[model samples]
Target: YIDLYNENHMYWVTADMYFKANQMGLLDPETYTQKNEDYSQKINEGQVFYSSMEWDFDAGNAELSKAGGKDKFVDIPWADTAEFPAWISRASEFGMAARTFVVSSKCDETKMKAIMRLFDFLFSEDGSRTIMNGPKGITWDYDENGVAVLTEDCKQKLKENPDYLLEQGANRYLGLVGQDYDALSATQANEGKYIDLRLNKEYVEENMTDADKDYCDFYGVDVPLEVSTKRENQSTIHEGYINLMPAENPTDIQRSITKISDYLQQAVPDMVFSETQEEYDQKYAQIQAELKNMGYDDVTAYFKEAWENAISNYKELTAK
Candidate 1:
């Protein structure tokens, strides 16, 4: 949820980043033409300094490895400055579960219990490990010391086959199985190791580059990089609450919302490419006026009222 009713927020999202980008000349003539692969290549070849994690991490590393190894990219926090002392970080929003996971419903208690039990196993440490690797003792097994390790055959397949995970049944039915990274075996025979191979220090040394180490070390982490990093950054998550008061249903305002979306698609570029600071500043007011003319005022009224109601409800719910 967002406070779109506030014009300041609107300005911050729309005009602020681009205005600052323009002032710094970050938007070069070639930016509009750069494709996804082009950006990745540029980052890989060291033509670009900074890139988003999606574009660079794997792509840059593969290219670097081919070039007899080089320093790679890492995910760093957005820098803080005097004017902006705080950063509001949020996790990826949840998507429709029906699309992500298969769902079934039944009134029978027996069937329901069976389903629940299946899910319980699926989410558990051993079950998740089974889904991620393969059948225990076949694909992976306990060593003499009790640490779960990939079998020699599985290791050979992983090295030889690019499609091993899917073709060999590890994550082949990934849509049905959960992908939890849980620690392996709790018994005395077992040493500390993760079911997910990516989290193992040995796996990291053999597969991932030194960049991941730097990223973990930057945050002063001791445990596997992913676990420690996610744990340490939990406090930075700003908002996870559902918006109890939603605006008018999308179907009711689809036309206006669609138009506004289209308008903003063009509006952003126009404002971003403005010739001067004065021109860029006026573009903000112009877009705001145009939005109201396009019935955004009525739309925002719904949000403003909703925001008030939601806040009121929240306070009441939380009251001691």
Candidate 2:
């Protein structure tokens, strides 16, 4: 999909393969299965890129160990000042662009300094501030103590129910109106004190760029309650049906093996032996239509409608 999309339109193609490759020392098996040929072509074409962010699982494990219990998981420090630059440099040597996720919720002097010269030209202080505070007073605030804070109500609601936060454009950090700074501040205040306690004002001030200051100027807009409610419900479903089952047990592992067997059994008749796209499409469409007729479409439509509405609501909230 990435190569197809990029080839059709010259967009910068980003993939998570670099991190996977770094951690596992190999390409992800799923990626190999889906687009090994295309990936090789893109590598030759110089169209593929890599991104590195906080090493979530590994960092979380480290934090758990430090805390001496599984009761608390730590947030990995933002990648901006971490070893991510070296990883990005390695990817660049392979003729790929490097992108990263930077968060302001936790700012430490050492990490900030490490990233300042390396990523300064690309992200700048303005960009970091924008990402961190989202137009400042609207979505976040500096209290009398000069500590960053989110609106109390927003923080409380999210703590009580995270679905509300995700639904109201809290997790949409890819484009202009991507994240809610106020909500993020609230999250940090509640769950990220470990990071905040380590931040130094001198480092933040010295490293900040004019653009970063500009990003801090705007106030955040409000998101609706309905959006949050729907997100919460979806989150519940995702946790119950998708995340928990696979992560905690071998149910999904067995199911996946079964699926592979079924696909192997079906592939010989469905693709390799078929002479044309028309033949494959005909058979696939027939099966798909049969499944839809058996209530697949109804269930899928319900999920799609909910997802679309949630996105629309988030956009609407962030528009202001």
Candidate 3:
């Protein structure tokens, strides 16, 4: 795409242009425009070939709705066999199932009990409701049919402040420390966009709207968690690497990771704009060589050892 443009038209290429070109900002106009006007024009005029993934589907949907369009971004299963041949046949596990919780050693017995109780509550249906929708009569309430519904007041408050629920102390206090996986899972059970199709049978039969059913049909999942669990069970490779604890001596490994990240930041654009396939291959090889020189091997060895130890420990503990 870039080479043909370069040969056919005398397009000015610069460092910034090269970096941003693959993101589909080649003709963003080197001038200022109002943010709203710019986005509306770019989207409505079809100036964007592919929208950036930085925006979640909800955000993208909201933005497009402003210009009288439905959600342009929706979830789709994607697999690249040429780049990841081994992964082609495997059903990769979803990341959300790997929920972990840790209690601070500094906590007393009282605090520990409180934390345990909170965790227990979050596992319950009502607790999940509060985590997701805030207190009754504020963000949500049950209708005559006993189905939970968002209140108009909640919508108004959300319009004024998107973080109204969090600010109003909807979720457990522990959630303030970090993203509470248990709380998050409960919330997903109640109102998760992707998993709404696969809600509990009773909940679905009673609570789902026609629109909700349609959304579920679009995604082809009757139950959100079942789909994730199925993929995880089918996966040949181990899951939850991102959730793993780092090595004790992580400084050198972190440095190497950063170096490789920085190299990719530049090399990706270089490869994309390369004139020929040979040029692209050379750039990729250069990236690999640079990363290898920057202690990539050492970092890999450290993580590999840690992962193996974890597996061994888990097996021993479970066997007992």
Give candidate 1's whole-model lDDT: 0.58
Tell me the tens digit of each residue's lDDT in model 1 across 1-320: 34344555634454566566767877544554578787766666677655434445666665666676646665555333332233322221221122243446645788788887887776555676777777887777777976767787877776676456556577754454443333333342144456665456665555544655666667666533443334422332212123345634566466777888799878867788888878877887788788888888667676677667766776675574
Q: Please report the TM-score between candidate 2 and the true structure.
A: 0.23
Model 1 regions more than 4 Å off:
5-15, 22-25, 28-48, 53-56, 79-131, 138-175, 178-197, 200-208, 214-219, 222-249, 291-320
Per-residue lDDT tens digits for candidate 2, residues 71-124, read: 322222122322222111010111111133365858798878876654553233
In what order do the candidates fall by TM-score, top score first? 1, 3, 2
lDDT, each prediction: 0.58, 0.36, 0.50
184-236: candidate 3 lDDT, tens digit per residue: 23334344421111233544444344544555676565642333433422333
Summed backbone clashes in each candidate are 0, 8, 3
> Which of the two, 1 or 3, has more lDDT?
1
Q: Which prediction has the highest TM-score against the true structure? A: 1
Off by over 4 Å in 2: 1-31, 35-139, 171-174, 177-320
TM-score of each: 0.59, 0.23, 0.53
Model 1 lDDT-worst window of ten: 90-99
